[model samples]
Target chain A: MLDQAFETLKTYDWGTDRNLLNPIDEAIVASQADPAARRGLEGRLVAVLKTDVTRAAKDFVCRALMILGTADSVPALAALLAEPEQSHMARYALERITAPEAAQAMRDALPKLDGQMKIGVIGSLGARRDVASVPALAALLGDTDTAIARSAALALGAIGTPAAAKALMRTKPTSAEAASAVTDAALDCAEGLLAAGKSVEALAVYKRFAGEDQPKHVRLAATRGMLACAGK
Target chain B: MNPSTRKISRRRFLEGSAAGISAFSIVPRHVLGMGQTPPSEELGGALIGCGGQGPGTVGGMGSGIRMIAFCDVDRRRVENAAKRFGAKDVYTDFRKLLERPDIDVVAIATHPGWHPLTSIAAMEAGKDVLCEKPMSRFIAEGRAVVEAAKRYGRIFQIGTYGRFNASRDPKQILIHKIMASGLLKECQAVHIKRGGLKVAEWSGMVRYEVSDPGDREWDLYCGPAPLRPFHAHRFGGTHRGYWDYEGGGLADMAQHHFDPINWVYAKDATSPVQVEASAPPAHPEACGMWGWVELRYADGLTFVMDSDEWGDRYDRQTERDVRLEDLSPIDQQKIREMPDPEPLVGFAEAVKTRQQPGGHAEAAHRTATLMHLANIAIRTGRKITYDPKKEQILGDAEANRLVNQPMRAPWRVV
Candidate 1:
């Protein structure tokens, strides 16, 4: 019956029935307690993806993988990263998988991909908060693609480390768009620093934002951040 | 993205639903999704107050769950929020909002005083409630809300997540560390310090200048409260500084601070036995800032909130302190493993499963009552006794009057 549900994903029409989601959700919850069941479900999903599948079909498979995917599932998802249509869904799944191998898969895909696909991998790496990827992410800050640079900045911000903060500063762009993204990421990094109780470092980040050139909101936030720092 | 997706899921959900889900069967079939619909299954709802907390609160519920109707006394707020959230139906009257049969839930984002009217109405209409906290303006209204929730068997969640999750607020983190260290077990009373630089203000003055005061449907906004001309401060921002709409800063921020404290101490099932306050005489129409207040339980555990010192202190009545090493290993382990609470995430989970959210109605009511009673003591300038079993203020006429405050028209406490 569960396999039938998995099969439905392959054959189901796009707008036909939402009830198709029921069995999928049921399987996800059921897999949580049963290791054998989880293994079976992951295998079924990965196996289905191996077939010539529709984008929507792969999307369903990726959604399921997000719930129950493991190290074994990373390679199949990584293969989809170069396919623009599937890259988004693949990252959606890969980013959430707790397995460090998913992070490795994303990091490995970095040098081989470009455009949005490369950016997606950068994001997944950040989502994974793989500290080891900092240097690689740092290098992307110098990339000519402003969007790419922005994404890399945003990803490093998501990673939120003193090292990430320093990388952002070292590679701080003069372009307004890239600078804005970097500063946004810096604010996030500062927040993370505060959360982890690196107050001095956080205050320094806030001080950077307190610069006269920064926009009003960022400056106001930086001012508030300094007050918070002083209060602590 | 698909209409058939919604229809099929709704039908499937009904078909899969168990014949009955008793109140005692707290783990409803919906949660397991084994024979039920998934979180991805769309359940529509309405936003009752669109101006303040409504939009953000609804946003946190995710894009999948749609708000079909929007209600607010202010026409501008309604039109703006409806357009912003893509809500097709808009009404100034919340009762009209409740009349919609399609709304599976109603997010009551009005001021705390109006909470009772909207929440009870929604629950009675078979809609689950997501209410902003200070669950009720008064103790009586809170009791009514809890009763309505039980009678209607609807999931009622107060919007405060302090009881449900770890907070990012510095003050909350301070409280969290204290709880994690096993310092919550009380010998007797507590004394709070006035940590924040700015003291709470209870100014009811409509200081800000506004061009169009007539834009709001003033009577609808007032609801059961005393009707008056719409002022910027009266209905919208800083309304918590007023007595008619809310119970000042303590009441406004009460659940945020106390809900988690109530949970950590297992005090959700009951209320304080007595409350006393030290403050300047409260104005008849405006809530005033309070100085020091004490809440004493029947078990002789006491809590004193001091605006002077600004930090929590266990009253050195009996035990000086029990360090981490002094406590039993079980409690220590429990503290160490105390689970992080998810707020909106849990609400979505509960909606799918029909279980109680972490910050459910009963706990909210208890915490609100704890805060409200302090306000009651401060206002009346007397120590007030409460019978938690009877759910009433005992032997104090003014305090009782405050709890069972009169309503003007078109609404009555259930």
Candidate 2:
């Protein structure tokens, strides 16, 4: 099914390629059983994706992204993820891979992604429940891309680790979303940490998102998270 | 039209006559027949929307055409533009400016809200128009503008400017040319990245601030949008954030990125499948524009259009923040080898020959539709369906309503 779709994409004309995009996508999503054939087709699809050639090439590149995103095709997908040559499309495909292996691969390769790709990788970790990645995720709080730092906070919350919660509390918020997400993560992290008898860390974690210098909403939420965790 | 008495030099006239008198005689008398073209009949130009885009366009154009008139709601812009361009007349009202018989071309660089109405009005007034990118704020208005141009037989060009962007740099042009030549065996994907810096705050060169008291003219600026506060920044002010006026950066810049893609594609298509926007939410200082929007085309192709919120690395490296550079030299040389003609030059040439402009209303509408769809999909947090042929929304009824907007009371494009 994937081969037929790519063949159709190959023959598809530039201007009207939008018509063929849906079926090709359907075939990709529907082709579950044949992993090897799907891998071969996906490779062909990726090859067409990188060129600055026709709009079709660009369009095909994006479609290839969706295919690479599938969870089952781990090794081939990981190979693409690790290859810097296809970094642009690799970033797009990273978000699609939801499995633990894919998440671990992305996390292991996290330091390698540029600021932009780092954000995508962080989001993937948050989605994949990578609790063991708390330290790496915590370190990204200072990522050049504020969005990446914010995503790291969210990933910590998803991981639900005490150390992650403590880290979120210490981090300064930039954008409203980043601040809000950090506050939520810090609160959740405080509760988890306090329950584990990590009071000092919890208090510190609770202060950043809720402190007087922070916005009223974040401050209130953090305070509440701290109080509830301390049984006050 | 005697060859000797005509303005054409005797030698050239004799040579032309020797070749084919009857064939050359059939040509329009004013064009090349007697060669006595009137200087006074030179093409004249006027500009509507004298704000940021308007003035910049004039400056970029240098002194190509005769600037005869200027129009804007603000007297200050009119005065400055007129003084700068030596326009014979300036008016706060556009209707009066359109009345000039000498003006053959009109540049509709007005706010996005007024684009459809102004362009349609200009065409109705018997003038060709060059409207800014994302030509219409709403779909119905775009359709109306297209109808008006067709009915009046007027020339219409949508200003995406990406066609001219790649032409500015040789190396980038070369890269594009190589890709165009199909020499690159297989390109897995191409990403068009722009800086993540807030455009509203970028240069600090232009300040857009909304005034305190609500002015009566606010309704005019709000033409097709719902009634809202008289935010000066939303209209002609310095802090023209995309949230209040346009669909943020995606609407403001996607046409630039999409132009090259459209050139490569032979068809006019809209997003038939759902597009996803995995972006951070809005910030107070900045509008809720995306870090970037990941658009999945119907063919399963995904286009990642970044708003400055994503990151500024690409912007720093390329030195094209708001402004764009053309394809690299390698791309340009490669493009030269391809069969496709240069799109913008095609339009300019057509202007001289009275032929249809490239990237015509339909093409502009298609690209604009994608931009709007991307914004809508991101805003709605859902994948929306778009049908290019009917030029209407599909499946998502609520999203369909967003496809067109009702004009503010009394400011009708029809």
Of the candidates shown, which would achieve the greatest TM-score relative to the real structure?
A: 1
CAPRI verdict (incorrect, acceptable, medium, high) for model 1: incorrect
For model 2, report DockQ: 0.01
Model 2, CA-based lDDT: 0.56
Can you write out model 1's per-residue Cα lDDT over B279-347, one digit (the tens) per residue? 755554566656777888775556666655333332433322223443468765665565543333357
Interface RMSD of each: 28.2, 35.1
What count of clashes does model 2 give?
57
Which tens-of-lDDT digit does each residue in B10-105 have in candidate 2?
122223332242243233435644433346435688888887789665543323357889987767777888888876598777878887778878
What TM value does model 2 have?
A: 0.49
How would the docking of model 2 be graded? incorrect
Residue pairs in candidate 1 whose N, alpha carbon or C atoms collide under 3 angstroms: B30-B353, B31-B353, B193-B309, B193-B310, B193-B311, B194-B309, B194-B310, B195-B310
Candidate 1 chain B: minimum summed lDDT over ten consecutive residues — where? B1-10
lDDT against the true structure, per candidate, is 0.68, 0.56
How well does chain B match by TM-score in each candidate? 0.78, 0.71
